[model samples]
Target: MRAVGIAVFLGLLAGAWSQVASPVLRPDCDALEVEEAALVAQDYMNSQLTHGYKYALNQIDEVKTIPRPDGGENYVVEMDLLETKCHVLDPTPVANCTVRPRQETKVEADCDVVLSKVGGVLSVVAYKCKSEPESAEDVCLGCPQLVPLNDTSALQLVDASLGRFNRVLDNDTARFALLEVDRLATKPLAGTPQYLAEYAIIETNCTNDDDDNCVPLASPVARKGFCVAAGTPAFTAAVDCALFTNEVAPVDPTLNGTGPVAPPVVPKLQTTHGLKHHHRLSSVNVPAATGLLSESEESQEVVPVVKRQAPMDTLLELPVVPAVPLPPAAAPVLQLCPGRKRHF
Candidate 1:
């Protein structure tokens, strides 16, 4: 009897192992439920991006499923994505946005997403992605690559680059302050790493004095521009920038009869390079860097210029008849309507 019981137990153990090792049927990539799970992962991935264009689903490459003992299934999904024209913060939904053309600054990515479905509800477990510029298939070993905006070393490089820019600028009328960092990257090569950055700057109210705390002006007279800076290990930086005057006048915080409010200020960051903060405003007129604009910034619309009429007191009354009459054929017509005096 003891031998028979032991045999039954061993047989039951083998049966359980067989059930656990059973092959899981892969889910159809085109299936509705599978598509939904993949989309959930895609949306989650897009939400995590803080800069540049949003990625749109290109194709669902594969989907694998594993059944759980508690009636839940785990989905492993792989998908391809292309950069879309719509920015990440744009009001347009990702489903409605169109992908960027290949000739443009297109970027592509391959993403792997894991999800779980339990009790008729699906939730994303985690996802990972690898993205690269479409044209950078053979990127140089020490070339710039896309990196997060908050990268510590990259930001430090940018700060140092800005110091260099200000030190070299020859103007004294205005100093440019950092407005935003559009994109940043670092090349971790052998000797010394390099940094590449694209950013925007605005003319600030502060002077060239190193001790002066300055704020960027928001008025139309205020100048704004975009800049690209590259840094090398030799402590040298190359910067190219363009400046443009804004069309909109400065906003008044007290216009609505409320008390004057202080504008948000960006805290100045210290850098290893003890370079002074002084940048000359360039006189060149150029368009704002549309490519550098994030989802929050839109191109400014041209405001119609309205002609102002001179005060009635300043109007000079002239005789209806011309002071000197010339030949009718060569005479210029001067017709002045009442209350509308023509000023020459």
Candidate 2:
């Protein structure tokens, strides 16, 4: 009976393991679909290089699909291409140097074309591309293939790497402006996954003019050992100097320096009343009567007060002459005169 119980326990363990170890299905896209996606990527590449430079298709290296949680696929297409740019010298009447000189550069580009099924048809949803520098160090290059896992985790790793790269170089304005992802790779490590990335830092605005141009500087840097699906995503990564240590060579002091390595200064609006001043006023003990008074109250209190007085009379001596003007009263005699009879 003990042996039978042991066998049953082993069988149960196997069943649980099988459930946890189920294989993920590969993406539903086929070879024809991959070729179509590559064409789309090629068109995208051409559109980006439309500005004076030209690009020629070299070859489509590989096409692979990464499964999405929402039943979609991300077709990662890798390709190599050559770019040509012309540096035309100004024509002069004396030298007649009108002949334009052209330069060619070779680069590898990886395009991620995302597709999703809609109304029973697979349609393109989103796409992005990263161009590889020609002379970047090999240590900065990511693995050629990505691990067969969820693309969400891989993308999260890429995002974390990008955030760190931006934060680290943000101080140096010239270095920050030109930093871009050159390559990205992923591989399975133990039970988890790791990502490797390369970044190209080029001083694109460099020119001979010291007043307006930045000093020319360029380098390739590598950031590796980014573990995805880790407990702490942001802190679990490392960056190394693939081309230069700590930082690139400092710009020439005589050249138009980028001032200082600091974060962009946002002009703060000046305010008459600031929070510190408000707090300071609140902390002081002000008399209740003086609360409404302003700073000019002291000057108003120093003015002299005017005294009011009664008016003086100028006609005081004229009243004594009125008493003598009333003379003594005289007696009058009454005469008895006869009146004539009235005629009828």
Candidate 3:
């Protein structure tokens, strides 16, 4: 059945509900729906603290079948949320390598990602990366040659709000595990502190490269392009693009940009004798004994001017990801559209 009735649709929403699920419909929901949706949406994020992933999100779509406690029967719905994970790095070159210490930051979010309605509840299908296809000659190719080292979703903290969730599975590789989220929360997620609290609980299960089981860094560790306070939302903000911990650079992009050390404990160090022999010293190497420094004040200055992202600007940036009602007999599969603001 359609989420809202035709008569109530107009009064309840700013525009018609899309017939398909897409990234565009992320923000187009009705106000009431948006608020309630935001709550559930946040839970799907799970707290980013323990896992080291900057964002953790799984939408209704990932709910292959919902085993609701209230009774009747399992509900089928699609849910999903987009999470942005950014970290900081020195971006300097040292001899044959470049390294940026890892820092982790996570956020709760509800932006332009599909959240379909099932029995009056809004949700989304989980995110899954398609493996790279093999050329005509290679029939044995199995997975993507490269996977993102950093993972993301709209509401990481909210997902943590749930008791214990394996939002991302395959505990081995950087594979994305899209799981159901609404099933974990005990309350309706919507503009409430309780909702935020629980979501943080879930985010802890998220990981950068599949292993959400790794140990967490101290106050500051980073990856990709971000960092966090070691706690929940109080630790980081999506809008604060400039605030970041040192992140290590990827060695071989072909190897999927992951290094042996998930988060390096000690970064660069300065040796007393190293400075004098600048020529003999590797280009950007910091002597391990001295321990400290990167990105000169002159170089760091560029971050505020260029890398400082517009936090508020991104909030309203994109239109909601549409979720149009399925055609009577047409296939139920959904599609995504970027700027067109709609999808099939």
Candidate 4:
């Protein structure tokens, strides 16, 4: 009887060890899977772009796999929107199918393709494509309110903070449209709870390089911020206040909150080089070194002014000044005659 009991225990332990050692097989998705998901997205876009709307298929910008809660995966494909039309079109190909140039406008849309597998069969769980509409004040509805970090329970604080950040970016009026929340982690700031949210920002029409007649907008700058939970309920008002009042510190508090977190550290942005700087002579000629120049001399010897032309599309390169090295501390002088002798 004792031998039998020991054998039974050993068998159970072996079974547990096997379960731990064996790798769990997860559903693998590849380019083919992404293509299948994109087809679903295309169908959805077509449905929305029928009758009056028209859009051309652009290249896929990105394809990301997000693990779902039910052991499934969601393939999110980011593609260019190209252009869209607002007028009705004829069914026939050669008929009046062509939308009027005046009625058509270039627009961008975001599409999310969610795929799931049930019983080893893959199917699209959700498909949606939302185009960015004209800027309106009401687009920022239901933005998260700012509450004191300590007041909110830890269980829901992260979700609340993230939801607020997303709402602000999803709106049309914002300079930078929030693409994705890459990293969001919380840390204590001098005993106060604070969040460090790292996100991706895409330049929308409001912030892009467009015509001078376009609305004057702020640049789509940094995408990371050291946000603290403290503000009113108003979405826009709260964000404005937080922007001005929030403590700009390091993402990781362990590193010593020394300075503001750096920006544009994304892999794509880092790999792509900015436009080269070009120096050109200005059309207007000025006097050489002398403060005053004779009218005749100005006409005769035109001093070509060297000016930098920064085009709207090109990135401006600022001159980098070399940092001056600080002098080493002077050696400590020991004077025995002026004061009491130093005991060694």
Candidate 5:
């Protein structure tokens, strides 16, 4: 009877030990480690974008953990984000930047990030994001705030801003031309309706005065930028721009001497993770240097010229560093780790 009792006790102890040692497949989202992994994933995802406003965490839709055989864990975080006023190259920290006002068109992104942890260290494995722009109907209680892309008055404002930008630079080497109209909105300020615009520009083959017909230069080198402009149709209040160039030139399709040359469609701006894009243009002389734009007298902000060292694909594989804590108020998403740090 004593030997039988000992065997039963030993079996119970082994079962308890196995329960404690087994990996957790569905850890609580509020767990400190899970929160840390989400923060790290957000930081890495934002670092991949070289242009546009930084995305602030709006909500954590879901968080899950998968246990690996090697004692490592994979964290999958799904989050919603809203655009902030902070530019990617701006020196100002994202925590200090304010979310874009409701009067403007709302641009939001949904991101799915996967991170792996081993030996108490975290690394981003993969991430993808989808961005959308919504009209600001709630601002005026069902009144549309988003201006039509083909609005004549809005187009005039954008053109005026571009003309002013060219005149300000007065660069004899290269002239910038409008590439696409990203957004246009109308909002009341000081009891007056004002126009706001977000657009893109490229160094073109034509001179600054040749605005009637202009196309991007077909050289190995190219300069592209995103700009924000605001003001009345008669005058532009402000124009802030950030320019970038690709480190490696895209392949020229005409060199093959096979297929007919195809017309260029406005390439979708890869503000976040996306497939590589190629642009084709007629051959033209590209300036050795893309002259910088001076500080906008009206905006009081200096234009930034950033160069992308590698293609979009290479940026995804970049090594992520320790994250900087974002302000709790900015990202009211997960209340995970109350007294601990959070980032977006």
Candidate 6:
């Protein structure tokens, strides 16, 4: 019996050794994609923002990017609109966001960081965003006191820039920027007229060369943008050109349920063919030394101006862009321990 007992113990020890407890090792392929997607998402958002801000604000700077939960980060695109907070994350002490269908997807992101107006005054980045799972067309998301985008005050900047002629709104330079917003996101006008003005500005400003800065209104490459903006059949000719590129088919307007169209109350400036647009004559001698952009050149290249007889469209035309960038040298990063910091 003693020998048998010793043999049983040995067998138990052998079985335990054969199935020894071990740390589970994950395969690279099997690792969850959340982190990777989050990284991509962070980068994607930043790229779009850099593209948006450089054009919208003439420059992009003072970025305070912070990490998100899923290995991503959020940035401070426009930090100035503290009164109404109609902008991106800034002034607010905390920032938050949620992935749709939160239960189905464990992914989420949020960040907290300080914002400052070091360079040019931080303008608000008009967002085509939904504040919560359920929001009405007339109301701003999250903040009740906040006015809807359709409000005159919400778009006061554009109106101020476009409405007055003798006193050109210095900020009217944003006109050329609007169309690129639509091109980048492909979302039609939200409930705001500011977006509409922005669209008009983009279409008017786009040239083959400056699609990076302004939107090409009648480009041969993308008919969808022209289709939305064009009432005349010039769009068809543009579509015929092989240059038009819409990687995906036309989106279904009716796919979603009944929603708010652009609020008529949203202001409308004088547009050719009743479409919110800028029009210029075919023949005009524009100078190239002062960054003065003719309608054609504005869309095609960044050049100087000779300022001829002011056409109707020149009312809100962009002034000569600074031939140079602002704050020539980079600003010092806000360091926690200046000169005393150590890096690992």
Top candidate, metric lDDT: 5
RMSD of each predicted structure: 33.1, 45.5, 27.4, 34.8, 19.5, 29.7
Sorting all predicted structures by TM-score, with the top scorer first, yields 5, 1, 4, 2, 6, 3
Better of 4 and 5 by lDDT: 5
lDDT of each: 0.56, 0.34, 0.26, 0.34, 0.58, 0.24
In TM-score terms, candidate 5 sits at: 0.53
Q: Which clashing pairs does model 5 show?
A: none
What's the TM-score of every candidate structure? 0.41, 0.23, 0.19, 0.24, 0.53, 0.20
By lDDT, the candidates rank as 5, 1, 2, 4, 3, 6
Candidates 1 and 3 compared by lDDT, better number: 1
Clashes of each: 1, 0, 84, 0, 0, 14
Poorly placed runs, candidate 3 (over 4 Å): 1-41, 48-76, 85-344
lDDT of 3 by residue, 1-344 (tens): 13233323333233222222111222322233444553443333222122222222323222222223353222122233322332112232211121111111112222222234556655432211111112324322331121122212213443332212233322332212222111111112243222111111112234554454544333233222221111232222212112223433425433565653232232221111221110010112224311111222111111111122234444344345466554354344443311121111
Which numbered prediction scores highest in TM-score against the true structure? 5
Candidate 6 deviation (Cα RMSD):
29.7
lDDT of 5 at 96: 78
List of clashing residue pairs for candidate 1: 219-250
lDDT for model 3, please. Answer: 0.26
Q: Is candidate 3 or candidate 6 better by TM-score?
A: 6
How would you encode candidate 1's per-residue C-alpha lDDT over 93-210 as one tens digit per residue?
Answer: 6888888555433566666565778987676655555565555564554556656667677677677776666667625567788876766667665667777776767788866665
| Alpha-carbon runs more than 4 Å astray in model 2 | 1-30, 48-57, 66-73, 84-103, 117-124, 136-344
Tens digits of per-residue lDDT, candidate 5, 22-51, equal 422444555767667766755555555555
Compared with the true structure, model 4 gives a TM-score of 0.24
